[model samples]
Target: MVHYDERTPHLHYAFVLVVFDAKKDRYKVSAKQVLTRHDLQTFHDDLDQDLKKVLPFYEKGILNNKTLTFENVAEIKKNNDQFKALKDELANVEENSNDKKAILKITNQELNEVDLAKKQIDSFKQGCLKKHLAKP
Candidate 1:
């Protein structure tokens, strides 16, 4: 049984009751209901009482290995956090790689311009040499 409504803007109470399906090897919701602001307290109290009655059966199922335990929830959370960190790290590395590629492209363009300038200077010097030699 889970109660959640924090993400929504409306002031409503929602409850979900999930049961383990041994045949399907998965958990399924057996019942779910929502209570508006008007009936929130009364419905919630009734739901709590119903859940209390089923609590012993749920516990018995866990003790008999018929139902899953929540011991792996913490591990799942840790793995999710690590996965997010790795995803962020990958994004950073990709961004840095893109920056490096842009820098390299600019550097290549500058080098080409420098080469062209050097060629022009050499051509000018050759023209001057020919002019002076012809006079001699």
Candidate 2:
């Protein structure tokens, strides 16, 4: 879904991106607002280029045959569990406590791990998409 606002001289656009995660068996939908029209084309071009880069890997069957192994799934689940634990600990910490910063840092690290896991799943989804579209 996409919408354009042309109330003023400048134009603003909003669009939704739907990405599938085959490993997790879910869809990750994100809505983005583009303040400048010029950047919209750049965003589309960048997205296309990124998908193109993954095509060769998909063709090689690396991403097609095994999107996520047992180990990968376990690692992702472990990271998610660790992130939840850290978030709970951070919430219990006092605002003025000296340990707050350290806890926050650890929480951020765990969040990054979760993000990486999501990226891996998304890449696998892209590969699946390519394979499906390529089939006659």
- Report the CA-based lDDT of candidate 1 relative to the real structure: 0.68
Top model number, TM-score: 1
lDDT of 1 by residue, 4-109 (tens): 5544222234558777889999988765333344453355456556766878643222122342333356977887899999999999999999999999999999
| TM-score, per-candidate, Cα-based | 0.49, 0.29
Model 1 weakest lDDT span, ten residues long = 58-67
Model 2 per-residue lDDT tens digits across residues 1-136: 3234543232234566777768789887743432345554356456546756877642222133433333456798987899999988887775547687888899999999999999999999999999999999
lDDT of model 1 at position 96:
100
| Candidate 1 residue pairs that clash | none
Q: What is the lDDT of residue 56 in candidate 1?
A: 65
